[model samples]
Target: MENSAGCSVSLWQKIVSFLLVIFPILDIYSVGIKGIGIGSIILCFILIGMGIRFLTLNRSIKLNPYYGFFLYGLCISLLTVLIHNDFSITAVAIRMTYFLFYTLLIFLPSSYDFDIHFAEQIYLKIGMAAGAFLILQYFSFWGLRYNLIGLIPGLPLNYAIEDYVEWMDAYNNMYTIMFRPTSFFPEPAAFTQYMAPLLILVLFTNVGEKKKLLKAAFISIVMILSTSTNGIVFSLFIWILYFVYINHDSLKNRRFPIFLVPLFLFAIVFAILILFTDNTISDYTVQQFEGLFSKNQSSSAYLRIMRGFDIYRQLNFFENILGIGLGTYKSYYATGVLTVYDGETEYMNSLSYLFVSTGVIGVLLFIYSLFYNVPRRSMASHALAFLILLSFFSSSLFNSPTYALSYLFLLHLDSIKNSGD
Candidate 1:
């Protein structure tokens, strides 16, 4: 019986590890009838396993460095409810579960001695596979499109391709029309959010420098195919910052200059191909850049920033200071605000969403929570955090358990290195 139980636990770990590996690709499909995403499902499993271990073995789970942050978020959740005097038990329960599950996943690896390298290998492999799929997509080949709906009758995965985007000039005129390759996500930006940290991990791993550059180049192409300005922008930004900051030590060698020749040549060739064969990409990129200062912004930028002042004006003094309420932003408040803006969408970015839900205090506490728990080990870890910070400008990463935990995991991995030093 003892042996059997140990085997069962080991098998469970392996299963969880496998799920972690494919989590990014699995984002395309729901896990069950309830349509909970694979990310949440993975966390649910982790939470269950941890609970079992704790109850059965009487083992205590070690606290993570960010426990206070988690507690702070919890306090804000409940405090907002109390202040607003409007409480839904179901809403409170759901919100708490989200926080608890995230906290559990963030601390699981360290507590259970989870195989970090195994998970990273899985992420990198899936990333490469996703890149390959995007390449095929560019050639008009498809994967996991509308067909996934048939697999789950009541819950359709049709949302993955429900929306279409076209590249437009600065004047809002359509310049190039194509179905953006989502790869295995509902949108191309999701791929970027999933891949960016993994790309950083691959580069920083003890792999050959040549292999690293090759992997980077391949992922860069996929990001270009994603056609998401956020994807392209963050990829280039992190790649440059990583090399300049983290990889600088590797550059102080005799062969470093020799390595640059091929890199320069490759860039030249890639640019020439895009310029001649697909000038549409070049024109689209130029328009996006020019739109920054032009009278009319690109459609994407316009959607992101068009109503910034209008939204800011909607926040009253008390709401701005203490926040209206935790989940109230999405429920009662944000909906009304969106209706006021002629049906403009909320959560255009993380900052705005944070302001709406948590208000000024919540946002400040959240930022402090992130940095307060950050393991400031080496320059590489700092660079990793900086990359995550850059990503925050584009989307609400913390709200997603997977992205939040992944960011924490990377920081923890660097902290391990720091301890060894």
Candidate 2:
């Protein structure tokens, strides 16, 4: 009877924990910034409670990579507040929230029994739901509208309607893309920033089960849709290259030089096929590449990259050790656009954006916090590192925080792997 009660309690804990993690906190939080996000507050409390419960049971969980991450992030938040003097307080708060939740996420999944594989199940469900919400927003609704507009072919809708209202209210007409929906985030790219890392996680799901594969694929497709070419293309590139690099043994299928040569050649050709086909799915990426080399691409992404660089350059040298203060990107809290560079089309990628936001020192600290898990090498390590690489290329500048979700997930995955070892 005592054992039965214990089993019942453990199952209930797993169920609650799963709900807590995948409960669409981002969607609820999306309604308002952190200050007003009721959903965020609720989940925050639940996660805190759970962590406290664990602490009570286990006094000596010992130091893991998460401790280092906590210290590094705390330092970043402090520096941002001290140097920027603008909204650095907000940065401090932001980093604190992320650190708290991230630390909980690292240990929370392990609090349950291993029988159900419930954590992976929650991830898949979250991806599926996020995908569905995005599809409803983009294709079924926005897709139909965009196509109707495209039929006319000469509509003056360069910017998203919201961006237009934004510029026009201030009495300017800067064009922006009216991107598809991101359930919790403001834009598709932001959604991609979170979901792309899940793609790496997906590779670790139960591959032996067809049901799991279908579920995983469904989530992957939805995430793929949530992404713009920037996130999708870059994530795909990094995943393929990194997966190939790390899984060289898995690819070999046999163990001989002659076989290895054929396998490598096959991989190269297979990769080319995936890239060429995938790149066309979104004209956004194609235009960026084309603009850089050929004359047929969108110049906005390139321009955004340049602007991010400008911000980094404009900051005083002292801002390197400390940030210009967290959230110091704007002054007087006006409807200000940070356009240090003038360009026809400016869409910033990930790495350049974060580098400016956090500066060189911040970036280094951030990278260290992200990948402190595996001192040894494995496919999983390679995959996580590559996802970080992908994050830099896709949405780092405007939406650097997207990587936070992925970072926590990756950290947990690493802990699980090493715990077994």
Find the candidate with the highest lDDT and give its number: 1
**Per-residue alpha-carbon lDDT of model 1 for 127-161, expressed as tens digits?**
89877876665555233322211022233342333
Q: What is the C-alpha lDDT of each candidate?
A: 0.56, 0.48
Compute the lDDT of residue 37 as modeled in candidate 2: 37
Q: What is the lDDT of residue 55 in candidate 2?
A: 75
Model 1 regions lying over 4 Å from their true place: 1-12, 31-35, 54-65, 83-93, 111-113, 141-155, 158-176, 207-210, 246-248, 254-281, 288-298, 305-313, 331-342, 378-380, 415-421
Q: Which ten residues in a row have the lowest lDDT in candidate 1?
A: 162-171
- Candidate 2: Cα lDDT at 69: 42
Q: Give the C-alpha miss distance for residue 203 in model 1, angstroms.
A: 1.6
Over 4 Å off in model 2, which ranges? 1-25, 28-36, 64-116, 129-186, 210-227, 238-247, 254-285, 288-300, 331-339, 342-350, 375-378, 396-402, 414-421
TM-score of each: 0.76, 0.63
Candidate that scores best on TM-score:
1
